[model samples]
Target: MADELELLRHANPVPVDGPHFGDGPLDHHAERHLDRLLRERPTISAPSPPRRRTRLAWGLAATAVVAALALALLFTGQTTAPAVAAPRPLLVQADSTPVPLRTLAERAGAAAADGAPKLRKGTHVQTWSMGMSDDKPPITLPEERIVRWHADDSHTEIVVATDPRHPGRPVLGGDGELVADGHVLSRQTYPPSWSDAPPQSPPPTDLGRLRAYLQEAEYSRTALNTGELLHAVATLLDTWTLGARESAALAQLLADTEGLRPAGQVTDRLGRRGQAYVYDGTGSRQMLIMDPATGDVLGLETTFTEAEPEYGVKAGDVMSYSAWMR
Candidate 1:
């Protein structure tokens, strides 16, 4: 294998005791190198040609491409890196019979404090989102965002390009290159401004009021199904970190609502253990993870149930995953 690779490289090799480098991902930089290799091949097109010659030229061009790709795949094995946005599907297997949502809700309600906690502003979250464009490879973008309000109403927001799932490891640079972990993607401070809108404003602690508040703000309807309720939970967590009372209220609301089935326990990307509830939609499945003790939201992940060949995404590919932290 060493002799074969050296023949392909047309370069010198080190001693057998040299340090080993593992296989690397075909990132953007590697793609550029492949493009250069293909371009450097001799030109094969012509203004006009006979049918027989045209067929032969096309065949030769195809052969050249296959050979080049084979070499690239064979030799680009120096350093390991994740090529796509998500390293793997975060699927959790059920260990036992599904736990009833009502039971968990009761526990959460019992753990609530007597008084309502003050209105909390903003959120700190980490997310992995997968996206693709026409004729391009699919990529995932991992980001950590924190939006906080300060005294006098001014707010500051910070976004970092990192995936807690693979701490200290290089992350796919949304565009395909690999960047160092914890790289600061963006930071901004906004002038003092406030809004009294449903989501922008703090949520309610009463179960009835909280349900109405979530429906009107997040669901855009008076009545909600289990899936919609889960969506509302996700949307709510995007803004505020709920207090004990708020979480208890939300848990009771979900417990009263029908259709959410418990999946069992699972650890989120942030390495926090939470209970999993799944709601299968027509086109996708939503897995909502929450703290069993407090009923606060932990994470929400979506995976498509159908294949999207046009986008190079399979049925089990994660569409998006977000983990919340207090």
Candidate 2:
């Protein structure tokens, strides 16, 4: 009985490395009580016929009492502490002009009725990317790329690396060659079928058919959501030229989408005025600029809405942007 009591006395009730909900360490009062219980050995009266059994029973009772008291302290500590709240969304500035999203959509739809430009035989796109540089102070550097894809899937690309801070300075190619004189740094041509074929057919012109096409064509492999749909539509416009009917359908689809908010009128990087619509997705914010006069997509930009310290990206930093024209 004494040996058992000694073993119980040394047993630690509080965990040293586990989840603790309490705001502070174990209660001082509880610790003192535990110490006292372990130190003050109970004295039993003179042995009876079942003296051994009596002592064993007494030791077991003491162990149970100590365990109950320890549990009470732990639970009390947890219940008294307050819970932590979730983080709030970061704030971002929007254009001052306030226009209803549906109103802009209607105007865009009307403009689309005017007819779209003739479809060309190839896809041409220009893109700009801003990213962290290796230098001290870690300023974002800008790079530009132009992609041209033939109707048969053969493609060519020209890349230019420029320092945004020194726009007038000449940029050099990787091979120690001067590329600032409107010369391509490096160019490669891929044979037909070297890559996946571009959308050979234009997107559907009806709202229902377009919605279904967008869902299956773009987001079928991944879980679909309103934000993903908006992003897919914006990406589609970047590559595929939309006619009046198709553009009107797209405008209507966006107007009916939940959580699509108007960000008012803003000038794109190309100095073209357009209505902006914003969609908040997981860890990012996508802004689509639509030309209200011609019902055309003028530009698209995505910015980070959450801080990703691992990537050294702060909230509100523009990740990438593209301005496109047929």
Candidate 3:
């Protein structure tokens, strides 16, 4: 894999005006100094594109001037960085005997009656995922990720891929480079967007208001039916730290939603026993496992119930499965 730090440096650049560097050859001593500065300070400001006149002024000796400009830009704070891409959303699937939705909702509501744990200032989630490739013996590219989101909208995440063939072994990148076994393979931190204000409180817990809130929030950008709504709700729960009221409200909303059929009881991938709920739609099945007593979601799994030979995935093949914990 590419060096994570190198990628980060390229992603965060400082904006500057004019051609700060001239065309003259750089002195070896100056070059060494620039290299040392870069090594010691990874967060140097980036230079902006030079104007036509400025470029002409720099002439053919721009190479030497570039080193000096680098130093100047590093001291000046004219930086402009690119936005990081949002994390991929989770998918869902299931196949089992169907349970009454109300029963599950009531259980969840009862659990909520005890009140939710105190909400933290930031969102923190850890997940383990498998099934990305279709190798000869079926490679389940097992990976783990930890994501954190601060109230300011800034975020950080670390992802590690493990060798599926050898449990606990770190997988080597395509270039045959290996991060020390059990070490983080990649990490990224994004600065917050000052324009976006932080939310004053958690999502509403009332059924009506919660539904409306979701519709207004970006979460409802795509039209969602009952089953899809449940899946989205599960995703929200995974992404945010909700209080007991919010959790119970969500359960009640799901209870009232149409198309949710219980898939009996089963132990989730995390070995937690919970009631299984399945939603079938257009060749795909989504299953959610939740604690029967606490209403806390245990796991989510999505499977292809119909064949799609073009993708090399057969019917009943797991599309993706994720287990999240605090």
> Highest lDDT, which number?
1
TM-score of every prediction relative to native: 0.71, 0.57, 0.59
Q: How well is each residue in 1-326 modelled by candidate 2, as lDDT tens digits?
A: 12322221222122223232221122555445434433433332232220000011123333443454456447756332111111122222373674565776677677665555444333323344443322211122233333345565554433444322233343333332222322344334445443222233467777776776777656375545876786576556554656656666777777788876877777654345677878888888888777665556666777888977755667877766665544
How well is each residue in 1-326 modelled by candidate 1, as lDDT tens digits?
12222221221111123222211123454344433432332232222210110001122333443454455457866254442346465656556455577887777777676544434776666778775544545567787665666676755555566665555555544344445665655446566566676676788877778888888766375577777777777778877877777878788888787666788887666666678888888878888887777677778888888988887778988888887765
Sliding window of 10 residues with minimal summed lDDT for model 3: 49-58
Off by over 4 Å in 1: 1-87, 114-119, 174-177, 219-222
lDDT of 1: 0.62
Q: For candidate 2, what is the total of clashing residue pairs?
A: 0
- The TM-score-based order of candidates, best leading, equals 1, 3, 2
Predicted candidate 3 versus true structure: per-residue lDDT over 24-72, tens digit per residue: 1234653443243234322323332211110011222333333434554
> Residue 78 lDDT in model 2?
35
RMSD of each: 16.3, 30.7, 18.2
Count of backbone clashes, every candidate in sequence: 1, 0, 22
State the C-alpha lDDT per candidate.
0.62, 0.49, 0.48
Query: Which residue pairs in candidate 1 have backbone atoms (N, alpha carbon, C) closer than 3 angstroms, thus clashing?
Result: 85-140
List runs of model 2 lying over 4 Å from the truth: 1-96, 130-167, 170-186, 193-200, 219-223
